[model samples]
Target: MNRVLAFDLAPKKDYIEYINRGREERIGTMKVSDDYVRQCEKAKEIQGLWNPDVGDWIYSYGSRSIEKVFGEVTMRYTKVWLPVQEDLQAILRYETPLVMLQAFNDWLYTDSGYGCVNGARFHSMQELWLAFVMWERFSKVWDGKDWKVV
Candidate 1:
């Protein structure tokens, strides 16, 4: 099985963004560009895919914001949403409770308190969730064998 790392699953070019309606509205009112409407529509389009709830993690192209009321405020960044550990556990349990419990038990008993799968060490809950997603989508697990991408 090929080794897969947690960072390998990170988005290279695109990222998710949080749309603060009040802030955006005020900013939009200050400007004449149609960026606000476009951003809202883009967010809507993305949200339409899974019908995500309030706390569900979703993907986006990226985002930017302006700060410093009196100076030139230009800041751009990628806002990747990392799921909280409890949220991830709930999601996994909802999908397959027994399997999740068994996996958790196995990991918990390991000498290393960290979670590692197929040589991928997960330092945080976010990394673990990303690994799970990658494995579910692109990996295949053979009985008594390491995971490999199919």
Candidate 2:
């Protein structure tokens, strides 16, 4: 089944790397875009088909507000969404559960013990810089209390 998802904007280098890795591993090329997302919303909006739930979904989809407000290059992020094929899905399904088991370890493993809540640990200044570059694009961050999207 197809599903809509939001993903953070990473660098061209990382994107290329991901593509390369996928190809080498027979994962196929990745497709990430928001054209379909925008098209769906536009179609619904034009038909006056929006409700609170639909409105919320559109607003939150792809971190649209965060990407627009934060501006790329500052944090260097843009939202991307794409389908996960069966081959890729299989790998993700197998790994997702096991990944959760190390949640505690991940939290304590970061070099600085800070960053995204999913608990990604940066091991180098370049990694930190890349994260800032990626995140600098998000308009707001969850300041532990509330979301400030401007």
Candidate 3:
């Protein structure tokens, strides 16, 4: 299988467990944005991703795809995907300060942090779960067209 993200630091079992939490529990109480719904639609469109016809394949393919973009996959029993320490570092390193600030406000300070231990790094499970959430968000803007540049 193709490795998902460049920073594949999390374990595979973690991704499976997180995704197995099912959709509703993973999204929590946050208002599901139009963007979020759009993302789910994108995933459903992928050929082998989330095949509803096959009971065993619900989240596996989507999990693989998520790993490709986000490095790992994870899920939390919450409304939004909270950024982990690695994600915080990554956003700061690769994104603008304003974007980082927005991520913090949206993730760190919300109920997403309710059961999380506040520390320099989050529990590995937490980090993986966030990756899955990000994957869903990333799917929203993804067009099925080839990604390669001519």
Ranking 1 against 2 by lDDT, winner: 1
My TM-score estimates for the predictions, one after another, are 0.32, 0.17, 0.21
1-150 per-residue lDDT for model 1 (tens digits): 322122232445322233443332222123211232233233322223332344433223343322112222223122222233454455443457778767655654554323443424433334444345434433432222233444
User: Model 1, stretches more than 4 Å misplaced?
Assistant: 1-49, 57-99, 105-120, 136-150
Model 3 over residues 1-150: C-alpha lDDT tens digits?
222122234555333223222232232222222333333334332322221221121223443222121232233211123233343245334357687556645554444322223423322443323333343333222223221111
> Which candidate's TM-score is highest?
1
Q: Residue-wise lDDT of candidate 2 within 52-142, one digit each (tens)?
A: 2211212233333312122222222232222223221232233464663354245334543245443344433323332232233333322
Name the lDDT value of residue 139 in candidate 1: 43
TM-score of 3: 0.21
Model 1 Cα RMSD, Å?
16.5
Q: What does the lDDT read for residue 106 in candidate 1?
A: 68
- Compare the candidates by lDDT and give the number of the best one: 1
- lDDT score at residue 118, model 2, on the 0-100 scale: 34
Over the full model, what C-alpha lDDT does candidate 2 score relative to the true structure?
A: 0.29
Worst ten-residue run, lDDT, model 2?
17-26
Ranking by TM-score: 1, 3, 2
Question: lDDT scores for all predictions?
Answer: 0.35, 0.29, 0.32
